[model samples]
Target chain A: MTNKAARNLFIFGSLFFFVIFLGLTVDTMNQIDGRAPEITKDVDAGKMVWQKYDCIGCHTILGNGSYFAPDMTKIVEQKPAGYLKQFLMDPRGVNPKAAMPKLGISSQEADQLLAFLTWISKVDTNGWPPKPILAAAASVAGQPQSRGQQVYQSQGCSACHSIKGIGGTSGPDLTKVGANGKDAEWHVKHLKDPHSVNPKSAMPAYGGVPEADLKELAAYLVTLK
Target chain B: MTVKYQSQKIAQYFYTFAIVLFLVQVLVGIIAAVQFINPDIFILNFNTIRTLHINALVVWLLAGLMGATYYVVPEESETEVWSLPLAKLQFWATVAAIGAVVLGYIWMGLDPQANKTVMGTQLLNEGREYIEAPRWADALIVVSVLLFLFNMFMTMLKTKKWTGIQGVLLGGLVFLALMYLPGMFYTKNMIKDQFWWWWVIHLWVEGSWEVIAGALLAFMLMKTIGAKREVLEKWMYIEVGFVLFTGILGTGHHYYFIGTPSYWKWVGGIFSSLEPVPLLLMVWDAFRTTREARNVTNKAGLFYTVAHAIFNFVGAGLWGIIHTLPQVNQWTHGTQITTAHGHLAFYGAYVLLVISMIYVTMPAIRGVTTYNQSRAYLAFWWMTISMVFIVLTITGAGMVQVYMERLMGLDYEAVKTVYNMWFWIIRAIFGVGFLIGTAIFVYDFFKIGKEPAPALAPAEQKA
Candidate 1:
């Protein structure tokens, strides 16, 4: 093509796509109210807190930012606030091997940050960050989960521990923990107060857990080998 | 040196200063690469290190681009810079701003509280990925860009000797400056904020920057390779036309999972799939013109130019499309795959483009038809090959991550197996390689071409 013709094409194409992009951007902005959660005062503060700590530099949210740490998009769902608070206050207290360093987060800041994450969890990302294929397959297989396994997921145990490769690094891998000579009684006591068994252990006490579920969890732990 | 005016020498300061920033970028980058394998090493905050690395990269490349523009505009417009004092003011301001920003980032790292609000504003480390410069630094950056733009426009207008290259360059710069505006504001809606962030980041690299690269590359090809101006400009228009058509819309790919509509899935997929077309056409045009040229005096410059085109295709065009489609991106979006693509793509597209322009501009400004060819060629291979090795290792790590973390439901931490560790190890080794290569490049850029030993005629065309 002659330079003039190509120039015309360049001008025409750039304007056309740019206009369309602007329109789409407007439409996207319009959809934000419906797609994203309301930004309460606390939520806004939490976002600032996130920025204040430069969290995005270490974590991904909605598949954006540096991927140094875990995805924060579903953190509120994967981890309960109680555990999150403990972790935020002193990262090592929740998990000894945690990569996150304590930044002296205030009790109030923790709540606000959680609120922000709660808002993030509610955003309609159009089903982004697809479910793990193996997890999906496990559910599809329709094998009934053990009561202890249900308790584990419900309690967000995976936030701290991994059974295989599928959990946090803060806690010990329990993939073969059943091989330990400790009985269910020992396991139960350790769960209730890990410090009683190992004084330096960073694991939080599960004493608040129901006695029945604790027994089931203990029973399940012994079978992991 | 055959520099036309006193103003042109300002670019030399920018070029030299930018290489120092390049060193900073690489040094931090090596630290970051190691941190990838062992996140527990809090000796340096990975976030802050990365912030410095990427921000330095942005600053240096812009410094390089501005310098190149200042040099090229004078030659293309057939007039001197509009105001030498203004250009000098702009350069010093930019240098001061860069120094302050770098110090500000280090300060933020030492005290995370520095990023906290002071009278209701984060003073240092805005903490966004690329534009993490503090609020004050941001203002300085805007003023600097405006000054550059004003000087450029005045110079272009002084003689009114317009070429297609200058027009495209102006359009691209305006687009770049406008895209940056949205990043300065904070959107209450996180989703909307993310949407605009993509516009700034994606458009700068893929959209406007590519247009500017086209102008720079076309000018170099015409001057150094002796290509016909008419034919090169025609090809430049076509190549840029494809770039805009695909790139502007290709911003959709980033929209897929960031709280944007599902229509983006299709739009991003289709448009981005065609993004490779522009790079493809650029390489074809580059090779064709190089082949048809009557004389090629600046072999080192020509080599960098051609290398930029080819690597852009491989690193950006090929690697980008690998995971751009929604189906593939769903698994790879936040994985090391993105990291791999980012490193390679930046190096190939803009980093190499800037380096190529430097290779071309240095000899021309020095009035040397050719510089020390052997050293230049050695640096090129050292950098280009080592960069490929780094990208490949990271791509390997990314694939393993996708398998274990996404497909296999492994924990993010669990992916740090010995197998994965191997990738990081290899990557760190090559990170050092890339760093050494950069050192060679900096040396070659300044030291090798210290004096013009002799003049050489334009070599005869092979054909």
Candidate 2:
């Protein structure tokens, strides 16, 4: 083939391909365009909160973001709005080991984010981020240490402690502390004054608690394992 | 040798800067890999390191393509560059824009809300993958691209000489600029936002960029191979045809899981499977032309040119085909499989193409025709081998993830425990190899001061 003929072929081929591409693009646009779920004002505000906090930086809404955090596309269906709000309010409060840092979003902003997530849950993800299989939580609530659990709860231990993945992350996860070698005596001392055991511990002392309550709390802590 | 057009000299500067950025990208990539093992590496955390790595790679590749364009256009047009000053100005402005974006990403904290009040939108990182540049940086990118397109358009008009190769390449650039606009649009719906986002990301990587690659490949073949222009040009058109026919619609592959319609599963699966056809054609055409012109030298240039084709096909083609089917992708969509394909495909296609361009142009720009043989060979083998292992390690990781997460339905932490060893292996072993190979590649580029230019072969002389 001559150079002129080759050039002509290229032009013709490119034009033909361009036409096909244009048709496909139009078809795609038709497929996606105007099919978006209507965005309510609350959802719109919530989306800004979502972007403002850059939630997608860590979380995947519809399979597009870092894998560092769990997918949020179906979060609304997975958890209650109140649960999500509290989790968003202080992620470490619910799961101390959670990598999600507090964004300092206000209650209002959190509501907006909830709205956004509620909207997102409606979008069809084609059943992605398959439901995780987690072992049922061990039932220690009715054990002999139940009084100690009451004392633990009364003291607002959740602010700095977690048991079976339920509570704040400001301190160590106590779910396995009993098995990990924190004896009753150690728990008592640590609870009374955390600095006595670990100088760098950020947990404040519980010295003002009654001696009986402290002993009960220590016993309950040891049963966490 | 052809006369050294002033714009070509300016192109050399861009190429050098690109190499520097390429090295930076590798360093940052290693830092990110290390973070996979130990996330507490001072302020150079995973998010920061990764953002830098991704952005640097994107910008550096852009710089390389622009440089390659400036270098190739004048020679193909048979005229001096139209405005060397405009090219130089565009180069600096482009560099400054990339610099602002990179620095902004590094200094800005990972929390999207970290500096919203203090920096406003000007400096707050958006945290979008590959589009993390702040609003100001986005503006700079648009401006720089516009300047680049204007300069190239004016150069062509002034020269009044255009080949089929130039037409395709310049057209690709115009498309590139146009596609980038969609990324700036804001939508309240996350799914809708992601839909438009792929217009910029997928379209650039798989669509218009392939045209650019086709044009560049055609130009390079015309220079190095003694084969008749008609045959190569015809093959170039056919390859472009495949690229367009497959790539534009192949974007549906990404739409499969991103809240798009269910029909996309069929559309994406069918079209993306064909995306590799053109790459395979390029592989055949490049090697056939090289074999036909057996007397040509510049083995380093020839090596990279041919290797790019093979790697691109394997990484972007075969690996891509493996998961392009919705059945496979349903399990692998966001897992390490995507990462594996990403690392291989990007390296195989875009990264290697830029490196190939550097190999082809650097020696010529320096008034030599070839690299130091042993070092270039070491660089090539090391990079090629390490890249293969990197792909394997990540693919392994992805496979394990798919099994534990999708099949077993384990939670994220449970899957992490199963895959931690693979991540460690990738970070410690393969990451180091990739870094060393990249280092050698950069070192080889500058290791030619004492080498002398050899006489052109009859084939090369005709070019």
Candidate 3:
């Protein structure tokens, strides 16, 4: 082919490709717009709790937020409503050293927040965190321990410690803590006061968990291994 | 040979070294991708795969930079290289140092302690640490950089006139030298160590690189495309302006989630997001110049330059902005989204630009007017397509990973098992494309030197 003809071919090819790319981009945008779930009353209530707490200031949800706290959009799916409610009433009750301040939420507000969370849990997040074990546990019904994992994150338990191989490395890995053979009684006492077990421990103590929730959380922690 | 041609000769050597390194880098990238697909492919070691990725990227970029500096320096100086022998010696020494470092990595494995040698210093292998070369190797690299600087700066001093392109090019090399300052002090603390390391790492890739790319783009178009000097120089100035505006602050993006101060989120996101603006302007300026050129001399080289512009826009300018926003980055920071960006931006903006320079200059060195345009064009498309596929696969995988883990609360192990097959399949597809591109590139490089020259176009005929 003559040089002029070759050059023309190249130009035409580039233009054609550009047109195809534009069409694909528009189609993808349409699909994304269509798939976006509507903001219903349930989601709006959850959003209020999120806004009131300034959750986005510290935590990211679906790739949006500050990194100070764990993402909460998926929290309801991972953790139980009862456990989330209790933790909301008092974060220090879940993780004594949690950086999250107690918001002093009312029972009704907490229920609204739970409903909002449940709504968020149902949104298709497209398989993040990429762990089947966590995904499976997150979907399990009445699993308070699964909820404990969310509590572990939202309460900033992961700021210093890693759980199930995901989190910050500043503190110790929690994967082996439960499997280390500590008795339930010992965990209860330790939860009340961590310094009793190890004098040099930097871990803070929660006042105490209610007996029932404590057993479930302890059971979840033990299964981390 | 004229003094101008002497400088061209030096550039030729640098180009040959860069092309070889490019091929090696592609191979290493393929291996790393394969390992990601099947963790057991390389004995189930993340450390090994990560090492390959990091080291290959570093070497390939350094090689490209060296070649680009050699090509641009003499033209800007209006003189030949100060000492060809010294330049050659520096090239061989760098090759040796890189080889030793790679050997250490494969032999002794990746020791954080072994990787401790700061730039411009001597690396000491205190014991069995393979990754750390003998301290002399580090000192050698510094000496080599000094020789390089002396050669180029002395040439410029003799010329006594500084063009905008020259200024940006020299500014980048000087910053590269300055990057070593923080690495002088090594700490046992990983957090502190990484903080210092980023000064060298981030500064080179995001900071000096922008300057180098802008300068080289201007210089090559002026030389090859018969572009108006004034128009190209103006674009160079605007390009450098945007680079400096965003480059310094962009370092903060790496600082996020690295246990640094929380304020980096705002600083890194806002500034890094702006990094694409200059690059986008660059794309516009490149194509505009090409379209305006009254005479197109080398069709193949022009094709490469145009492709470089398009890929830079899509890969560096667009994709970079997507993840640089603070909100988006909070989730995508360490995921495969970052990997996708790295593959494209590094190869597209930097590597391809250097290769474009080689296409323009290698013929000048051989005193030829035409090359195997078909082969060169084919290789370009091969690389472009493979890179696009790789980016899509990684981005798709990252989305899936984030949803499964963050949204679904799936543990790492379960997620790993579920996504294992898809990761491997996608990576293998990318590898096939990458390998094909590399083979074509190598074949074209060898064939060009052997082919008979075609009739000279008006531009080259004038020269």
Candidates' C-alpha lDDT? 0.85, 0.74, 0.63
Q: Which stretches of candidate 1 lie over 4 Å from their true place?
A: A138-156, A164-166, A176-182, A189-210, A223-225, B40-42, B417-419, B452-463
Which 10 residues in a row give candidate 2 chain A its minimum summed lDDT?
A132-141
Question: Given candidate 2, what's the lDDT at residue B38?
Answer: 51
Residue range A1-225, candidate 2, lDDT tens digits: 666665566567656765775676667566663555678999987876776565655566676776555567776764445546776888767555655556577899889888888887777667665543331122333345478988976676654455664554435667887797768889889878877997644455778999889999888777776
Per-chain TM-score of candidate 3, chain B: 0.90
B343-462: candidate 1 lDDT, tens digit per residue: 999999988998998988887566654456777788778888888999999899889989888887777876864448888889889989888889998887886467654456434323
Model 3: lDDT of residue B87: 84
Per-candidate TM equals: 0.95, 0.82, 0.67
Q: Which model scores highest in DockQ?
A: 1
- Residue B149 C-alpha lDDT in model 2: 79
Candidate 2's docking class is acceptable
Q: Write the per-residue lDDT of candidate 2 for residues B1-463, one digit (tens) a residue.
A: 3236645767777878888998898887776666555555556446666667777888888999998988888877766777788788888888787776776665555443454633334346665778878777778888888887777777788767777788889888888889888888667667767878998998899888888988888777766655676787788877877887788778889888777777778878898999999999999988888888755656777778888888888988998999889878877877767778888898988888888887777766777654466676787787778878877877887787777656754445445533556665564577778778888878777775347655555775544
Best by lDDT: 1
Task: Find the 10 residues in a row with the least total lDDT in model 3 chain A.
Answer: A27-36
DockQ scores of all models, one per candidate: 0.73, 0.25, 0.04
Poorest lDDT segment (10 consecutive residues) of candidate 1 chain B: B454-463
* TM-scores of chain B, in order: 0.96, 0.94, 0.90
